[model samples]
Target chain A: MSMLLLVRKETVSTRYKVVVCRDLGPDVMPLLRGKPELELVVWPEDRACDRRWLLENIHGAAGVIVMLTDKVSGSSLQVVSTMSVGYEHVDVNAVAKRGLKLGYTPDVLTDAVADLSVMLALMAGRNGGIGISVVQKGQWTEYPWAPFGFCGPQLSTTAASPTRKIGFIGFGRIAQATLARLVPFGITHCLYSSNPSSAPSSERDAQLAQKYNLQSVKRVDIDEVARESDVLFILAPGGSGTYHVVNETLLRKMKPTSILVNASRGTLVDSDALAKALREGWIWGAGIDVVEGEPQVSVDHPLVKEPKCVIVPHIASATLETRRDMATRAAQNLIAAILGGQMPAQVDLRGFA
Target chain B: MSMLLLVRKETVSTRYKVVVCRDLGPDVMPLLRGKPELELVVWPEDRACDRRWLLENIHGAAGVIVMLTDKVSGSSLQVVSTMSVGYEHVDVNAVAKRGLKLGYTPDVLTDAVADLSVMLALMAGRNGGIGISVVQKGQWTEYPWAPFGFCGPQLSTTAASPTRKIGFIGFGRIAQATLARLVPFGITHCLYSSNPSSAPSSERDAQLAQKYNLQSVKRVDIDEVARESDVLFILAPGGSGTYHVVNETLLRKMKPTSILVNASRGTLVDSDALAKALREGWIWGAGIDVVEGEPQVSVDHPLVKEPKCVIVPHIASATLETRRDMATRAAQNLIAAILGGQMPAQVDLRGFA
Candidate 1:
């Protein structure tokens, strides 16, 4: 037959596909539905997806929705718009090399994380961990009121401030939210030390300081951040760039009555160093949200065993309203990116230092 | 005269004789030693002296130091002065009728009480009680993550107006102290309900409010008091007249997110009603220093069982420094009153309603 006489075969339009590695709960499904053109394959398995399974099922995928348990590799990043702020699980270099857009839910969870930061601060500051243990172990009855019994360092906005100052290791979004919460509890000044290279503009710093009516808000050197703070918050980003920022040297520089709160990354802190600091009274107490190797940490962990340390499982962004908003926004971001429109909310991949 | 001198000479030369019902601990005894001439007779038991035993041994007492447990009755007002702020055990009306100068430690312990009030408020508002319970019960590991888990309210200062509403059930010295502590916490408006007859002049209120930069400080009716408070502190004096002032009707008027803190007296609140309110969410949470029938409260108590209610055994004035100060001041007050000079710090035994 002649070439012009032959009829061209019908070509099917390729749909944008996503692999939800593990099944999302009932609340998350409606958000992904009603987009007739997108294809979503739910694994329906509650366990972590095997590497082979993820690679096989992720063919021609432009999106990969994942929970904290998923291990997304370079091979799986054929196309993926992640649904989380911490994209450590996903192969970032691969995504960059493939020229694929990445999406993450960040600012939406700041308020919830901030709320939790304050919560841990209060709990640890008040000696709540030990106090409740006393109650549970039926010890309160035996030791009703021994003078100087069971009292922890109060987060005195006034008493602690005259000599002990408030400082932060990383002055980021959650740290700012925590400062906002602490202002009502009587914090007048805040000194912070972010990475020197990540230093924000003076105008933005001034705005933040004025916004909170802080006496002074400035980025200082790491040593100054330690020496001045009565309540030092560890809220830096994770990864090799900022690991072990609050080690023994920085901890030893703090006041004996100071409290340290970490609602940020796990690897950013040295737990063994923190334990020694707490035991030796280098710092009065510490409230840690992320341990060195969380999810594998046991009751016998040194940080958990330390009486002065308050260890909360990583739950800074776990409020009901906030989580829902995060999931919904994340889904929206993926859909918008695939639909050839602007994301309602998008994470700045370039901003991760 | 030397042939037949049989008159018994009273030990009037020992002007500094003191009888303490209980042993003042290491922190307090040093303050007492400041007055070297003063002789202190502590009870051997070091707990509490029986009323009859005290009456017999209190013959030559220049100062009678009593604890919350001792009952110094109308019959036992032979001492020159009684020492303590809460003289309910001392029978202060009888002391005045018997012409014994009554002294009390008031302003000295204001800061401690105020610090405790804010502490209780923060603890209750942040759900420290519940969180502590969870961590102690080993529930933290059992249920690691959930959407609506461990969420509590937060207090943040707004930039436009840096203030949160702070209300007191009664406006007294302790109430004023509590208010002072709250000022640094961004409290701008203070509402209170005092005894209608003992209400201070508007000018006095205005002056005090201006000193603290509070926008409005006024004595309001109980209904209005309950309706507008973000934190309603029960700091009123306790007696039959003020019993159950914060009952169901008043609690219902409070906001659903409001926090109730009682470092004042147990009788000021209706415990049964408070338990019901907490369970029903009439108010968000409560922190109680004094329970209705405290020291007798068991784990099965209704308020104790309620997740939102944090019951602290009355330790508002329990700081090491403050307690020592109080004890020393109490001793001074008793000594000053006994010597017939003007009592340094005397509580006017007027209508205590």
Candidate 2:
């Protein structure tokens, strides 16, 4: 019988296999060690997923745990699991047809993402980025105390009115958490537009609205969401289908004093369009956690150059406690799937299919 | 006719009759047009209460519209109707003895301060200082794509506890506005401590608390106030009696994960002590709008070096809308008092005496 093993020799030895397509924190290593009979092929080079290495090593593997950077396809691996909620990187239909179980970390990260969503919302509302840039660029002394200087939209209970509605571009788990934080700030209405077929359950939406005493929690058109919202939060996934959901046209519909917060993927927004929007006053301001072509952004980046925009380096789920929990959970999900058991948590593929 | 004109001649005669102690922007000057009987002393420098200038222009004036910087002493001038709520700078005992009807701008600044109190509380809880510093410092290179790096306490209601307990160091008008914001945050309790002689009316607190359905609207000892607060807000006036009220002893009594917001005054907190507490984990974090020695803080300031501390340059009443309102109200207060009418708004100092 054939078995899988990391080959120092040309021939494989007898060991059940799990392939880690990317390097995780060291805390995740022991989850594999718990099974003495299984072998783990972990990518030594910590980087964007090495396609060649993954293609070669993922052959005949029982399971593979991957990150967003990795593309898990039929040509690469089966029994795919991801460390994030969105499984856009993995070909879910291929996995289903191959009879491979798909594992992913979901509810475990709701609190962390929720925390960041609120942070970004507040940061955008407070003009924090402009204040920081002013200090960093040595503009503090040049600027004296002026009445209108450094004033951003004040997030308050007083902001709750019929005209100024709270909008969500894609209302998901983290969006709900953000709403919980916003509820206290006196937002009484909500408008959201998600994947047409993958909308939230009526019962769940009803419960959320009732719990917060909101006026309504119904789905609306994208343009309507933008037009009505005083603050539009983009909390959806990033993929080809949903790329650049918030373009210049949608942004122009927002109120002049409105704010935009993007704690999701950078590709969900077009940076150039957003930069133009900020410069031309299409929207009042934005707090962006994820930026297109980020981690490579220079001081002169278009969005960075805009005084009205606040850019954070994709830190939505980066709490110390939450990171450790994600690492541990991702490790457990991989281990459970390889050891003749159901995945600890698996992504539901019905919607994706 | 030897009336003590608190107005300076050289500066006041050139501009308007009232020497606006602090710089009120140009919009205010138009309100005093053609009031030839009244001379306005404008301070070219922001150091409005300069002793040399005050002594030189101390004779023959009807009214004065001063700011927090001016010290209206018996030796200097008699009638001081300041444009700010706090009259600690004015030698009130001397004013009382000299029979000067002191006017102050109190109610005008309540909303601004209260708005900032909540802003500081939210900023402190979210580690806004760290997030702000990180991006401006260009520290996004070393560990990019981090899932859990910068996270702080998020203020929200959960299933475990639907209500937040907001405690006030001083139950004044600003404190009540702060409480109003917390009400929508599912806050059900409001505990406060005020100077025994000037405590807020129990009937007013009860009625306001009942309007919001708060659990209790009771005055508590300082120790209990410190202990019970999830977000302890310091809104008390700055003076010797309330100095360093949140010292190590009180900080020790607070929850480790709790946040402290001081929009009131820097003198209310011990900066060095607060820095130590933040470093040694005595308390979670602090946000200060004012510091002990403000406008003189350098990069090496002790609180500036503390990561958890969010220090703003004393901007509690710094909103555009509020500032304009304050300037207009201050000028009106001076105009009204000088015309032998009641001050537009006055702080009753009888209780303090």
Maximum-TM-score candidate: 2
Question: Could you tell me how far off, in angstroms, the CA of residue A74 lies in candidate 2 after the best superposition?
Answer: 7.0
User: What local lDDT does model 1 show for residue A120?
Assistant: 70
In order of the candidates, what TM-score does chain B achieve?
Answer: 0.84, 0.87
Count of clashes, each model = 0, 14
TM-score of each: 0.77, 0.78
Worst 10 residues of 2 chain B by lDDT: B9-18
**What are the per-residue Cα lDDT tens digits for candidate 2 across B123-235?**
67766677656654566554355334465554554434456678899888889887876665557788889898874578987898788888888898999988888889999
Cα displacement (Å) at residue A112, model 1 = 4.5
Each model's lDDT: 0.69, 0.71
**Model 1 chain A: which ten-residue window has the lowest total lDDT?**
A156-165
